[model samples]
Target: MDNVNQAEFWQQRYETGSIQWDMGQVSPPLKAYIDQLPASAKDQAILVPGAGNAYEVGYLHEQGFTNVTLVDFAPAPIDAFAERYPDFPAAHLICADFFNLSPEQHQFDWVLEQTFFCAINPSRRDEYVEQMAALLKPQGKLVGLLFNVDFGRDEPPFGGTKDEYQQRFEQCFDIEMMEASYNSHPARQGSELFIKLQAK
Candidate 1:
C-alpha cells in the first residue's frame, strides 16, 4: 500500500500493462444502468473519476452524453484514451488526482464509481465520501459498483463489505440502493454491489 494512492504507481501499471482490474469494456451492470436512463439524462453533467481506459466515458460519448468528464491521475491511460477518442473534448480528459479536484469549480449531476474506490488506500474512505459529496450538485448521485468482498491485501483493488460501505458512505449520502449486482461481468459476478446513493 506504500504507493497505492500515488499516480506513479498506477501510471507504471498501465505502462507495464499490469492492469488486471480492467475489464476492457464498459461494466455490464453500469451499462444496464446507463441504458435505462431517460434521454433527458443525456444532458446531465457526469463525472467519472479514476477512469482507467475510460470505457464508461467512451460509452457515454458514443451514446450522445455531451457533458461527461473523465479524471485520472495516471497519464498512460488518459493518453491512450485520448488516442482512442480523438474527437472527445480534450478538456474533458483530466489527468490529475481525484482528491485535488476543486469542489468550487467542479460540480456534477452524478459521479460514476467503478474500480476507482477499491484502488484507493483504505484509510481514505472517509475522505472519498466527503469529496464525492462535495463534487456533486444538491441531490446529485454517486452511482456504480463496489466490491462486496474483502481481498485482505496490501495492494490496490482492496475490497470491503456492504456493512462497511454503508457506514462509510451514509454520513454524506442517502443510500437509495446498495445491493448485489445481478448483471455484473462474469469475472465480477457475486463479488460486486451496484450502488446508487443520493447526496444529502
Candidate 2:
C-alpha cells in the first residue's frame, strides 16, 4: 500500500475508537526501563513512531525528558495528544509517515518500538528494519515489545515468531536482548518478547 492509503487505514481506526492495542497507560516494561535511566539521559533524543495516544511520550515529558518525538501519519491521535499535553513541544509532535521521514531531518539517540512493527505491512518488514536503522544514531538502541505468536489475520497487529524477528532485525541491529517479558500486561503475558537492539 501507499502513504495515503496507510494513513487512512489508521485514521479510520482512531476515528471509530477501535484502538484495542492502546493500553491506556505506559507499557509496564517500558516504564520500568524509563525509571532506571539516569537523570542526565533525559536530554537524549527519543522517537516513538506509530505513536497512537502516546502514553509513553506523555510519561517521558512528565519525567523531564527534554527531547521526545512522536511520529504518526494519522492526524486524529496527534490532535488528541496536543490537547492532552498542551505544553509538549509542537515541533516534536510530527505528523508524517515513518518511512518518509529523513535521517537528515530527524535522527535519534533511541527509537522506542511499541506496537509499530506489527502495524506495518508484512511485505515491508525489511524496509522497516532499514528505516529504523537509518533513523538512529550510531550504536543507538531500539527497545520495546513484540508479539511472539501468530494471530493468523490479514490485518494490522501482524504477529511473528522469535526466529523470524531474530533473522529480520539481525540485518541492521545487534540483539542486545530479545526474550519473554516477565512484566508484560496480563493479556500479553508469555506471548510478548521485550527487545533491546543496538544499531549494527
Candidate 3:
C-alpha cells in the first residue's frame, strides 16, 4: 500500500472509488451540529480537512457560510467538489497535505472533522492532534465523528477507542463533549462518537 501520508495514496483511492468511508452525504450528527450553529458563525473561518467529495463543505456553502475551506490531498475529489459548487471560493478549495498546512498562513475559528482522523496512519495520531491544535484559533473547536470500534486492520478508516482519543486530544484541547452519536447514519449508528473539543 502507498504511504497514507502521501497524496498518491489518496489520489489513487479516489480515482479507483475505494473510499468506503464516504457516506454519500453529510453525516447525520455533523448535519445536526451545523444546523444548530448560530447565525453569527456564518462568517467564521471553518476548515474541513480530508474532505472526500466534500458534501459537508457543500452543505456549509448552501447554508450561507462565507468562509468555509475544504482541503483534500487528492485532486480528484477537490475537482469534483469544485464542479459541484462552482461558485464556492476557488481560493478556499485547497488541495494540500493536511500536515503541511502552515499555521502561520492558515488558522480557523473551528474545524469540522468527519472521517479524517481514522484515515491517516495511526502512528501519526499525535501529529494529527498537534496540527489540528495549531490550525485553530484560540478556544476554537474541533468537532465531528470518530469511529469507536477498532477496525483491526492496517488501512485507512483505522479505528480506536475513546480513551485513546481523549488522551491524545486532551494534550491540545479541552474535551467539551465525547459520546456515542445517537444520530449516525443507520450503517454507522452505534459505531461513531460525536466529539466537540475546544483548543486549550
lDDT against the true structure, per candidate, is 0.95, 0.93, 0.93
Q: Tens digit of lDDT per residue, candidate 1, span 65-128?
A: 9999999999999999999999999999999999999999999999999999999999999999
Whole-structure CA lDDT of model 2: 0.93
Model 2 C-alpha lDDT per residue in residues 45-147, reported as the tens digit of each score? 9999999999999999999999999999999999999999999999999999999999998889999989999888889999999999999999999999999
Error of 1 at 143 (Å): 0.4
Q: Give the TM-scores of the predictions, in the order they appear.
A: 0.99, 0.97, 0.98
Better of 2 and 3 by TM-score: 3
Where model 2 places Cα greater than 4 Å from the true spot, the runs are 1-5
Model 1 misplaced stretches (Cα beyond 4 Å):
none
- Candidate 3 structure lDDT: 0.93
Ten residues in sequence with the least summed lDDT for candidate 1: 149-158
- Give the TM-score comparing model 1 with the true structure, all chains together: 0.99
Query: After TM-score superposition, what is the CA distance of residue 53 in candidate 3 from its true location, in Å?
Result: 0.4
Error of 1 at 175 (Å): 0.4
After superposition, the stretches of candidate 3 with alpha carbons farther than 4 Å from their true spots are none
* Clash count, predicted structure 1: 0
